[model samples]
Target: MNQRYTGTAIFLHWLIAVGLIGVFALGFYMQDLPLSPDKLKLYSWHKWAGVTLLVLIVARLAWRLSHRAPELPLTMGPITRMAAHAGHWLLYGLMLAIPLSGWLMSSAQGFQVVWFGVLPLPDLVAKDAALGALLKTTHVTLNYTLLVAVIGHVGAALQHHFIQKDAVLSHMLPFAGKA
Candidate 1:
């Protein structure tokens, strides 16, 4: 198996990573502001960013399905393989769920979700205060959960590279040397 991921995969991986960090930082920082034009503008940007992530994740998922991922090294134990697979699936799930929940929450509050200020996305549910509150909770919870998952994923990658000296981490890098 190749030690490095395809160039496209590496690009998408880093792109998503940057976007996630920016989105999360914006979300947390914007909350302290009083409702003003600036606050509204920040929220608009956050909403649009979330929408963009949803679209990109869909494309990423399709690409992943079509392209085979690099194989784990032969020395990897079954437990490690299972954990890796599970972690990847969890990341995918969070990628899909976070934006979706945010969209639902926004729709419930009767806010339009415009994609990058051009395309408009249809609402997943009708406006309802109760449902909106629930979705807000879900969205916030999922965001933190995603943060933890990302940290764990990165930590594991570092472990594979620094401690195990395996191809696990290298497989996701574009120009990684042969294992």
Candidate 2:
């Protein structure tokens, strides 16, 4: 077995991870700011980042579907393997859901989302303040969910590296490790 992910996979993994964390922090930071032109600008920037993230995630998913990931070691416990599988699937689901919820919220709030202030995107839902509020809440809730999942994901990676002494983490790293 290769015992390592493809270079493209590793690149997309880190790119998406960093982008998610950045957007999450930006989302929290922007929510409490007093209404002003700056706040509006921040919101637009946040939406732009979210849309970019959606694109990256879609590309990553397509790549993952087309390529085979390196297998876990034979020594890995079945329970651990199952947990890893579930964690990965949860991450994928949240990645898609979080941005989608944000896009829907913006649409429902009657805000047109323009990518980086360049290209305008279609609305996912009709303008409805009530629906906007609901979708906003959903977006916030999913953000926290994504945060927890990310923490757990990192913890598991550390556990695999330091405790399990396995190549699980290394598999995704852009470096050499024992197979």
Per-prediction count of colliding residue pairs?
A: 0, 0
Residue range 108-171, candidate 1, lDDT tens digits: 9999888877889898899999999999999999999999999999999999889988778877
Deviation from native of the Cα of residue 158 in model 2, angstroms: 0.3
Q: In model 2, what are the clashing residue pairs, if there are any?
A: none
Q: For model 2, how does the per-residue alpha-carbon lDDT over 1-179 read when each residue is reduced to its tens digit?
A: 66788889999999998898888888899999999999999999999999999999999999988998889878888998898889988989999999999999999999999998989999989999999999999999998998899899999989988998978888888775555
Worst 10 residues of 1 by lDDT: 1-10
Per-candidate TM-score against the hidden true structure = 0.95, 0.96
Best by TM-score: 2
